[model samples]
Target: MKPLPSLDVLKTFLVVDQKLNFTRAADTLNVTQGAVSRQIDGLEAHLGYALFARQARGLALTQQGALLVAPLQQAFAQIGEALAKGAAQSGTLRVKCPTCAMRWVLPRVICLQNERPEIVVEVTASVSHGVDFSGEQFDAAIVFGTPSLKGVSTHHLFDEVLTPVCAPELWKARRGKMPTPGDLAGKTLLHPTRDRRDWLRWLNAYGYEGLPSTKAQHFDTLDLAISSAMQGLGVTIGDLSLIEEDLGARRVIAPFSLCVPSGAAYYLVYPERPAPSPALQHFAQWIEGEARHTRTHLAAYTKPIHQPIN
Candidate 1:
């Protein structure tokens, strides 16, 4: 078998051959003339043939050098093409999630992206009502609801438990009385406009027959809703997982012992038709693993409590 030339040597030879001057080639390559000369020398020794003829005028390619140029150029061209294709394939994976989910999931996603840099992620907050996955272009969506939509692949991420949260001052101001559905009649109710179903379901399950004409405040996003609650505007029912940080920080407090098991669950949904991209598949798997970790961690630290909404 013939001895293969080193890539560095071939690169140096190609540059020198094109420029027809060792000094110019060395300058272009940011290498010393002596280094370029040594590379040519090493290349010639390995090939057992002189590739360049040194002359008073400049460097000229010998017969062997001329013969090697075509194939070497072709090899480098192929390598460049492959690298370009690979870079194009390693694209960003767009993901959609609600603002509340983003607060919890973004950190996890950052860790995943760091580990798998080849897969870029673009997270967009979806504030619109319903799972409008079709309206937007996203590789995957993390939605809060049961897997009821047909023709979509849904992976149950987590079950949500709703707790009524209000500013700590609001709870204290209530004067030791746990607020009931009747008490909420005059008080402001900060509601998430994205999914009214959540509040409706809670109201139904609690046997609130007459819908109260209460002072209502609507927020287009969860963050806004939570912020409103924090400012002591009104009580907001929020997912336990999402508000765990707030509860720990004493930013918000559960005033009433009444809680509702939200029928909604977080699900990772993707199109059922075409096969998922490799990046999407990797992300889905990582999310499920993270969910498992969260379940285990929460189980150890927190005790499950059911608070019925009155």
Candidate 2:
């Protein structure tokens, strides 16, 4: 069975049918005439009939459209009445993330929920890069890099800092000496297979022209790659923004005293329409606060870069 047209489409159909002019209908709806035409097209497609007849002057309703007009108008009136009678309901927010943020940001998000004790946030994480929200169902997403979607809104979360990090024991085995970047020849390189750009940039920045790309253990996510690094397994490129806890706890040591920006940044992205929901707004504010606190706390522990590791 065919689905009934939505209230918005029905409303548009009624307005255009009454005005007999696309321009007049658009003006009344405060939308472009193109929008009005599209809505009518959608409605007609849904009903599998032509809703408007092309006329020299303007639009004229087809027989099928005339039949649907009264019922659709009445249906929209009922929907509006119900809304006016306090039929609003709160909705759950579904969010997705990359593996890096899952470790730090996700836990902090739980704290945000506890602090407010009112909002609910459902989070999912993956090791993949560049998730397509267009096909997926999500109220918002905390993703790497800027949001490029046309209708999407973005909030800058934080910049990424990449540095070589390893377990304390691994560095201790180095005779308590900070090794140069070229010295990485002896250690295993735990690479985040998903992100290639930063790894290359890091190597190029330190002038490690001949640094042999030896594959030790490959991980798809920073969380896993860094975990392996912490196990004295290999050195991984750590996103400092996500690994502040590990760094502060001395679980990991930055061998090279220098770190560089990861080129891309984290962002809070959501569809922009009628403003954000209360839950989404609270989540956004909470993440913003968390990022601020993280940056501030990190500045206290910021160490100066030594002479080049090359």
Candidate 3:
């Protein structure tokens, strides 16, 4: 056996192989393009074969480079997993949560720390609604979609119930009356998704035939959109369960009584293989209990909206 190439060079090779461009790989690695070129050159020298074929357009991964990609990815993943397990032993559980669910998960995380000072829960909020356990190092994730995620044990939290919410003052302006479809005429609509799926679903479920032609603002996440609504910017659709505190505190009020199910629910998801850490187990049990409480409390709020308006 000969000598092994530097781990740094190998890592750089992987990045360049994935990107197929030194400038983009350097951008991702936060290094200069020249530095990335040097690392690839050194790695190819050590391997005694050309890893990338440079063309007029760009670089393509040679057969040899393609072969190294999967193994390197798996090796790095295993190393990361080992490091994460070592960190977990220190009594910390890292959890990934969608920004929209932060309203629901953050308070519970604080309460959990208060109740169980021995366990520390670190929550990372992201705009993405799903998590990729393969690439991500989180002990678990609070995913906000259907239970279609594979190879993970999913613990159902609660189904998302969508309804229009706005600042208390906005609702009060209507003389404490429940807002009808026509009330949305002049006000700007805040959309959580670019396609405005949430508002569309709620309107369709409420039996409104035409889409509102009012000015609209789109946000990357429901949390931002709801936050905008609380500032009296406009009305946005919100998940009834997640905004329970906002409703209770009168920060935001649901003007429409008909809250329809969006067919997606939040789930506590973790890998099925390599049994979960003890810290994960404890947090999972605690959150599952909290979710149960929420489901029971919001029972009336999430009732089916099929009945006709009086």
* Highest lDDT against the true fold, candidate: 3
Candidate 2: tens digits of C-alpha lDDT, residues 1-310? 7666665677778778879999998876767999998888877777778988989988888887789877765665455434323311445667888778887877787887778776777788865434434334566788886557656788887777777888988764368676677667777888877555556666776666644556566776778888898898978888888888888898998777667775678888876643577778778887888888888877643455322222
Off by over 4 Å in 1: 1-88, 114-116, 129-135, 148-151, 173-187, 194-200, 203-213, 272-274, 293-310
lDDT of each: 0.72, 0.72, 0.83
Report the C-alpha lDDT of model 3 over 181-207, residue by residue, as the tens digit: 888887889999999888888888887
> Which has the higher TM-score value, candidate number 1 or candidate number 2?
2
Candidate 1, residues 10-35, lDDT tens digits: the string is 88888898889989987767679999
Candidates, ranked, lDDT: 3, 2, 1
Ranking by TM-score: 3, 2, 1
Candidate 2 positional error at 160, Å = 1.6
Worst 10 residues of 1 by lDDT: 128-137
The C-alpha local distance difference test score for the whole of candidate 3 amounts to: 0.83
lDDT head-to-head 2 vs 3, winner: 3
